[model samples]
Target chain A: MRIRERIIETGLFFSALSSVFITLGIVIILTYESFGFFKEVAIVEFFTGTTWMPLFAEPKFGILPLVSGTLLTTAIALVVALPLGLISAIYLSEYAPHRLREMIKPVLELLAAVPTVVYGYFALFFLTPFLQNFLPELSGFNAISPGIIMGIMIVPYVSSVSEDAMKAVPMYIREGSYAMGATKFQTAFKVVIPAAFSGIAAAFIMGISRAIGETMVVAIAAGMMPNFTFNPMEPVQTLTSYIVQVSLGDVPHGTIEYRTIFAAGMTLFLMTLFFNIIGFWLRKRIREAY
Target chain B: MTRSAIELKAEAKNLNFYYGPVHALKNINMPIERRKVTALIGPSGCGKTTFLRCFNRMHDLYPHNRYEGEIILYPDKINIISPEIDPIEIRMQISMVFQKPNPFPKSIYENVAYGLRVRGISRKGILDEAVEKSLRGAALWEEVKGRLNSLAVDLSGGQQQRLCIARALATGPRILLFDEPTSALDPTATSKIEELIIELKNEVTIIIVTHNMQQAARVSDYTAFMYLGEIIEFDKTDKIFTAPSNRLTEEYITGRFG
Candidate 1:
């Protein structure tokens, strides 16, 4: 029995250590490769230059267009997801009957399970045509359609987490609100939401992270032109999409062009890390407020 | 019984409650006097809290929780527990302070002003006036007056419960229900709450469920001894404490068995 216990303990230790090692390995590789790219392309120019003609004879490797593309899509996605997610979360947590909640939550999660590639086509073929009818200036491959689709894709992440947060709020607080003659809507918005604000904020941050990292939907729907514009109507390329474009294409190994993917990947990592830090700070502040 | 002279705020007539198949409260009949404290004393699972919750139609919040008969609010003469009556309407007139200090995660001022805000009273001056009045009514104004914008959860446990009381009072509720409001509090907090309950009865009718017989004895004008989902005895607090009554009430109050 002791031998078996010892074996299990060792197994678990290795499993935990493996994940740590893998993460450290990725960071090391990304830093190493990005360093190689930065040596050829001036760090200031890569950040400041507007044109991203990396494959041209005189390659300009400005990251702003990709960054703007990411920001615009993420901003649009947040605008769509935040309210819809919170309202749905409130409904599920406060208003839905047990049977209804049980039935609906799984269906909402199933939206997340639907492949992002499928969502990409849905954005390109179905939603784009439907949206173009109203706004004639809208391009066939534009940021708006993909951003909306990405928002729809992330609803489960936001709502599921937010609902769990709302549901975790003790029944007694809600009871206090209800006993004061507050209706379901009023109690949910005024009491429950405030109580679960930290968790809800975390959910919004999770949605933002997912939207920023999301590649396929934007890669397929938003045309991969590195356009330095915030307008959702125009074709734009996000950092993730740019990395995907390079990695999929034939770029020779160990070259400056090949190293750009690592630079983009590192930037993406930094952005997500930045948001996570903000989420951590916000949660602590709200908790202290309580 | 010279019943006609005393003003009654509400009455539970043959009230029965069920949680799914379990009969939680059975054939409860009681008078809630106007501007007086009525204490329900019982052991755990005796359904005292269950009985108090029925007054504000709290059972309606859950599924498979059914109410039979009536909790009729006097003056209005409305059956509060009836399916036709909205729970929110009954709740507007009746508020509850819970066993634990379950203050909303909001500022002290926001907590007190919540009930009024729900009722659509949003004028800043009116809110400020009402918040102060409620805080004063709950005997929490002096300590919290200076830092009303601070988070309510920052207060001690006793203060939080008092804030909840203030929150309930802001609506000017006709009745206040306290379900073991001090059970989670320390001894000093418990005594303060006891004093507050006694003082509060002059304004709104109060119904409190307490496991502590001494609390019932100290704060209540009237007392109901409940055992096994039934009220074993109902009388003046003095009479119930001093005089001979039901064998079970006698045994329960004397700390022989609960």
Candidate 2:
């Protein structure tokens, strides 16, 4: 019996360690390639230069345009997802009737299950054309449509996580607020939301990170032009899209063009890492608060 | 403290409650006197807590919980059970402390001030004063005075319950219900809460449900013994403890089959 139990425990320990091992492996690979890329191009030029014309003459290694594009789409996605997802979470956790909640929650999660490539096609083929008619200024493959679609795709992440956090709050706290004469809305917005603040903040960060890491939709719908402009209606090339652009072509291995994708990947990795750190800190702070 | 019996704070008439089809409270009729601590004592699952929650219509939180009959509040002359009467308005006048100390994840002052803040009392000075007064009323002012902005959850279990009391008190409710408020506390904390409940009666009408017969005897002015969703006996603490009314009440209080 003891031997069997030991074997089971060992199996469980290794299973848990696999996730950590995978993360470490990715970090190591990213760091190794990033180091190789940095040895060729000056780090300052890669970061500070505004132009991202890596394919053209002189092959400028400026990553600002790529980073800016990434930020633009992520910002748009966050703007759409955060409020809509939070409201949906509130309705699911607090207000929606039982049958409605049961029916809608899975459907909301189904959005997450849908392939990102499908979403990319929808953004490129359907959403852009549909939106173009209303606003003539919208380009054929603008950042706005893809960003909006990416936001819709990631809504499940925000809502499901936030709803779970809100649900984890003890019922007695809500009862305490209600006993003090707070209305349903007041209790939900004030007591429940504040109690679940850390979780909600973590959810927002996770959603933002997901938006930043998203590749397919931006690759398909957001144009390959690395314009550093803030206009959502115009085409822009994010870090992920540029990587996709290079990978799709027959760029020989060990070339500067190939190395630039590593540099961009490192930047994207760092940005996501920063968000994850914030989310971790918030989750830690809330653990102390409760 | 004794007050005029005629000056009833709340009265229930044939109150019956059901969770779905299962009847939880059966024909509960009682009067809660003004400025008196009334203890509802019974075995587990006897509907004592349900009866207490009915005072503020807390069961309305979930769907399919049916409430029959009327809970009348005096001075306001309001029927608490009527659909026309808003539950929120009733809750403002009658607050509750739970079996477990469930303070909001906020500072002590904010927890106390939450009730007032929800009612739109935004002035900093007014909020500060109310926080101090409510904390003092709950007998936690001296201990917590040093860190008014410290998180409520940082405090001890005893202090958390006191914080919850302070929270309820800040709303300036006319009645306070304690649903086994000291069940999760230590003996010292339990005694402190009992004393606090008695002290609070000078300002607010008190309705407490307890499984401890000794606690009910120690603090209550009026004691109601409930058995299987029915009030087996209801009388003054002295009469209920010393003499007897129902044989079932006697047997149960004397450690017979509950």
Candidate 3:
């Protein structure tokens, strides 16, 4: 019996060690390439400078445009997603009957399983043309189309997490609210929503992280132009798209230009890390509330 | 008995309830008097909780929970089974305290003031007075007064239960239903809640479902003994304990079989 237990314990320990090894590998790679890139480009200019002409002779390596584009698209996606997602969650969790809830929940979740590439193609082929007919100045590949598609892709993420959070709220809270002569909407908004706010906040932060890490949809629909423009109608390039653009070309290994991709990757990694920390903190707050 | 002209609070006539073809409450007929404590004592699964939930129509909130009955509240003669009368409105007049302390994750002040706030009572002065009054009524004011802003979840289990009672009292309902309110509490907290219940009997008609036979005898003015969802014996508390009409009540009260 002790021998059998020893084998099981060894197996569990190795599994845990393997995950740590994988995480160390990623951090080491990101740090090595980032250090190589910083050797050629001053870290201050790379972070703070507005211009980003990397293929030129001087190769001014400011990455602000890419960061700005990423932020703009993510902001637009959140604006479109947060209200629609929360409302859908409230409806499904609180108002819908059981049969309808069963049918609609999976159908909504099916949107998340649709490949991001498919969403990119649909946005490029169908939505851009439709928007161009109404507004001729709209670019064929602009941030607006991709951001809207990304918002649609992320709705399920927000709504499903928010739904679970709302569902986890105790029935007694709703009962207490209802017993006070409050209307159904009042109970949902004033009582249930406030009680579940931390969970909802965590969901929103998770959705933002998913939006930032998204690649294929932004790469396909939003053109790779590293211009410092905030206008959604103009062509732009996000950090992920810029990395894809660099990796597609034959930039030799160990060179500053090649290492710039790692710099961008490191930046993306840090931004997502920040979002995850915030998400974890909000989740802890929610658990403490319960 | 001389009865006053005051309207009947709640009346159940030949009420039968079923949970998926299993008879849970059978032929329950009773009248709840105003501003008095009525205790329902039975073994587990005797449907005391079910009968208490019916007073506020909370049982109908779930699907596939059916009943063949008429529960009427006089002056309105409202049939609880009718779809016309709003369940929400009926529940407003009859609130419940659960077996567990399920207080919302809010501050102590907000926990007591939740029901009043939901009713759109936004005046801070009125809310402050109501919160203090309700907490005092539940015998929790002296302990929680100085730290009204503290999170209610920080309180002990007994304090949380008193907060829940204070929350229920804030609504100022005509009837209060307790489903084993003291079961989750310790001995001292149980007596505190019991004392509060006795004090509250002069203000609101209360129906308590408890498993503690001694608690039933100690706090209740009227006692009802139930078996298999039927009220086998009901009388003054002394009579039910001393000379119960049914053999089953005698056996169960004497700890022969539950």
- How much DockQ does model 2 earn? 0.75
Ranking 2 against 3 by DockQ, winner: 2
Per-residue lDDT of candidate 2, residues A143-184 (tens digit): 899999999998999999999889988888899888888888
- Best-to-worst order by lDDT is 1, 2, 3
CAPRI level of candidate 3: medium
Give the DockQ-based CAPRI class for model 2.
medium
**TM-score of each model, paired residue for residue:** 0.97, 0.95, 0.94
Off by over 4 Å in 1: A1-4, A281-290
Q: What CA RMSD would you report for each candidate? A: 1.7, 2.4, 2.2
Cα error of candidate 3 at position A217, Å? 0.7
Ranking by TM-score: 1, 2, 3
Q: After superposition, how far is residue B249 of candidate 3 from its true place, in Å?
A: 1.3
Give me the candidate number with maximum lDDT: 1
Q: What is the TM-score of chain A alone in each candidate?
A: 0.96, 0.94, 0.97
- In model 3, pairs of residues that clash are none
Put down candidate 2 lDDT per residue, B91-202, tens digits, no spaces: 8889999999999888898899988888999999999999999999999999999999878888999999999999999888889999998889999999999999889999
Instruction: List model 3 lDDT by residue over A102-164, tens digit each.
Output: 999999999999999999898889888988998899999998888888888899999999999
Off by over 4 Å in 3: A1-12, B1-7
Q: Model 2, residue B77: what's the lDDT?
A: 77
